[model samples]
Target chain A: MHEQDTEGVKIGLEVHCQLTSLATKLFCSSPSDYRGKPPNTNICPVCIGTPGSLPVLNRKAVTHAAMIALALNFKIPERMLFFRKNYFYPDMAKNFQITQYDRAGGVPFATDGHITLDSGKRIRIGRMQLEEDPAKLSYDGTIESSTQTFVDYNRAGITLVEIVTDPDFESPREAREFLNKLSSILEHLSVSDLNLEGSVRCDANISMAGGRRVEVKNISSFKEVERALNFEITRQRSLTSKGIKVMQETRHWDEIRRITISLRLKEEEQDYRYFPEADLVPVTLTKQFVQDVKKGMPEMPEERAKRFQKDYHLSGETAQILVREKALADFFEEAAKHSKDARQLGSWLAVDLQAYLNEYGKSLEELKLTPKHFAEMANMVSSGEVSRGAAKTAFVEMLKTGRMPRSISEEKGLKVISDTGFVESLIDKIFSENPQAVQDALKDPKAVNFLLGQIMRATKGRVDPAVANRLVRERLAAAKGSK
Target chain B: MTKKQRQEQFISEKEVEHLAELAKLELSKKEFTKLRGELNEILGYFRLIDEVDTENVSPTYHVQDIVNVLRDDTPTPQQPDMLLEDAPQKKDRFIKAPKMI
Candidate 1:
């Protein structure tokens, strides 16, 4: 095995999720709603680490952490201890940050968990811990050239659930997929909104076979995470192929430049000398308390996706995509309530509506279309009240004006022309006007489609193509009989 | 210096220099020697507590036995300008620090 080698890559993620759903900071009563606020507004004595101002852990923060743990199927420890992670940074008002350490009598809120991706690949979760968020820092210019840095303490002291993952991902795409699924799970658990700035952040460590590991940090978005990993993988492979060993170092993702830049060498001491946090006592969670939290847990994405496939007869892929966003899933269920045909509603939502949203870079929440109207539109198409094309037209109009599908169809004259006599008359007129076309239709069956196209154009595409085709054939046969 | 000084010296003068570097302080040669001696004496006094250790004693993290201190998750209006007024240097609403290298 050692003689010949397969160059395999290993990836691990350390993801940070902000517990914005909680009401207060991790250790203080200051508002956790720090986003978009002016700098330093949310700062309190305890958050800014004022001397002699002791910290009291927020009980709700612990509950939220435990809820996330249960949602991820992690084993909640009996007693969770906090530790002082000693570091020096302006963002940390306290020179030492209170975090969960794995050693030195430090116990995190949860440990030993795993979440499976939609592909059925399991990614083991190392630990999930609760920690305080540091302040926000902004540079006046490029970080390398800036003459000054600005600090906003508004984000300081907010609680964060840091989830660490085992080295399981073999590709950038798998890592991205894992993050998306994890974010959806967190959203479904109501532990996080996942849309707020800095609500979720990821740091990835990547290494190729026989190559030193490189850690990429400061990747803010899901897409950036994938791109950063991809860039690192290629960089490492090229170095290894050229007989150059990859240096183990901390790299920064220059998102704008779309490249990874080395930030620090391995020789630098990572002195986060963690010791037990003396201000706050350990959080004790009994089995009964965990059971209570577990009882209130909502159905996660995996179960809901399975239900969608089983009940609605949706495909596994479609169900997976639909359940990726909780709001979209809710919309699907709401529309399903109005229409008995789940397949019709599922296809429209998962395909047409989703396509439109993607085209305009809009979200389901941003669209003005309601589920009631969406269901009505789907019903109209299925009931032969409107052709599929006409229904789609009404959908776009409804999306733009926020009007009901019925009223939009009425206003746009999109109602299907299903009356047999009226369609016969329209075909009769088209035949009389185009004698050459009629002669051509009598000679060739496909020529009747030309006349049918005319009726469709005259009716503004409200006439179903099948009905138009049938009426045109009947009228053409009647003409041939008269001859 | 305290009377409870330990015979064994744990923190050397070099260790003081390293600590000063980490704190980003520039200590003069005279000040370095003076501070090193004072810090060592302080550590020597702290060593006396090691003699009374009980191996079975559980670690105490906090003085109070109370737990589960929490506040309702809600926002209270804050005067950001008032807080910024205390900063020695500020631009707009943010506190300014030296450009990190």
Candidate 2:
């Protein structure tokens, strides 16, 4: 798992996360909640850039941006300005994007932050800028073969906080880990639901030591981010080994082709001649504003995970898994309130419940399984009313029909039979019906296991195996003496 | 005047051409040459503003002193096809443009 002379892999990320939690678009009063809305419905005069239209900065977008910065431990500046990033794309209805460029007079919203992964490798955040998103482009065919392109303005002018990180990642896996931790932190802050389509997008810049940088864009998911960077690393290594200088360029990740393709050479670069946006006003956050946002911030993932270990006595790994998702962690806390044993509850949730969720490729929110029902199921197992196996089957039943565990158990008759008299009588009946098993038991004591299995099958996996085994042993001994 | 100082205040024809290309604006050769002089004159007037002797004046980014200008997080209700109807060319509720690169 080692390589020579290719160790100088430097990777940086410019991640754009939409502030979908906001109510309206970034600079306009149009609704920002336009994920599945009809195309062009959410566009307003300000967003559509009609003549004489001016942008009024949405205050909530700035607050969410500040919250994200605070969560990342960024240095929040007092005064932040937006600059027009000039570019030519059909999707950019305004012809220039209103973004933040750190200049002599203007500053980004936040800067100089760091996030440490579980392995304690810290990635330095260069800066965070609050900007407006451009309209989405849908092509009739692939970009290389498309005859026409269509634009959907519904996503136009949405607020996005672009987080730029210093070139600190050494491997693609580390980059993926940083993104996962970052996504988890963002989710914990309720800034944006990263589950939504296009909520978070990343552009990665990768290079080797003394080599030109290649930027890979259009990485649609976290998985693809790792893949693109890995591809770039191998591609760069091969190029360097051949003594060919790597050219500085922008490449697009062909997700369909699973390869990186050069989109524009350095010579064809779009000089985004940035200038301070005159239409929008500068946002000046007071010391009190930053402090207020910090005060209102919820407990972040690392802190919550530590608290889970200390307070609930959960193992570090289990606590980390539970707190990875905000909703799942919340569900665990709610379920812990009803269940008596935290350790047992945590094990079931972390193992069986997680397995079920993974099997269906679903998040906790996607399932109708509530904390109340989950707690009830856990308590039943703790109280010995249901075996662990039966409870798991009941859980699958709960998921398939959205029924409570109790009802599912009752409906499917999977309840554990603890009645000693009922169990003994069932064993007697099994001995009589399978008299050959009784005779075999007299010669070989292990033959009585057949009767035990029959009792279990008759109870439909409800009978505890230990109880069935003991009763079958006693009944077989009596029947053997009579024979 | 020296070339450096002259170029500092005047927008050269080459700079004008670069700006036009960046802005994705098509300009004829005659218009490009004529517009350079016009723009440079306007820039000369702007360079005059740099002559103000405000030794320690804090730069103002916006004319208004408002710090926090935010609207409550709420989605504004609007008709679905209202904006699409305004587009000169549209297909299936999307604004049609030439082939995108």
Top DockQ prediction, candidate number: 2
Q: Candidate 2: what's its TM-score on chain B?
A: 0.83
iRMS values for every prediction = 2.3, 2.0
* Pairs with backbone N, CA or C atoms under 3 Å apart (clashes), candidate 2: A23-B73, A23-B74, A59-B70
What is candidate 1's lDDT per residue for A1-483, written digit by digit as tens? 011122498999999989878878988878888777767888877787777878888777777888889878799988888899887787887888888988777788899988888678899998999999999999966778889989888888899989999999988878878888888888898888888877888899999889888899998876578888878887887898899989888899888999999884634356677888877776789898899888888999989999999999999888988888888898899999999678878888889888888788888787767789878888888888888877888888887778898888888888898888898888878888999999999999988778878987888788978888877887778878999
Clashing pairs in 1: A23-B73
Looking at every candidate separately, what fraction of the true A–B Cα contacts under 8 Å does it contain?
A: 0.64, 0.74
DockQ of all predictions against the true structure, Cα-based? 0.42, 0.50
lDDT at residue A463 of model 2 (Cα atoms): 86
Q: What does the lDDT read for residue A134 in candidate 2?
A: 91
Worst 10-residue stretch by lDDT in candidate 2 chain A?
Answer: A1-10
For residue A75, what is the lDDT in candidate 2? Answer: 94
Distance from true location, Cα of A127 in model 1, Å: 0.7
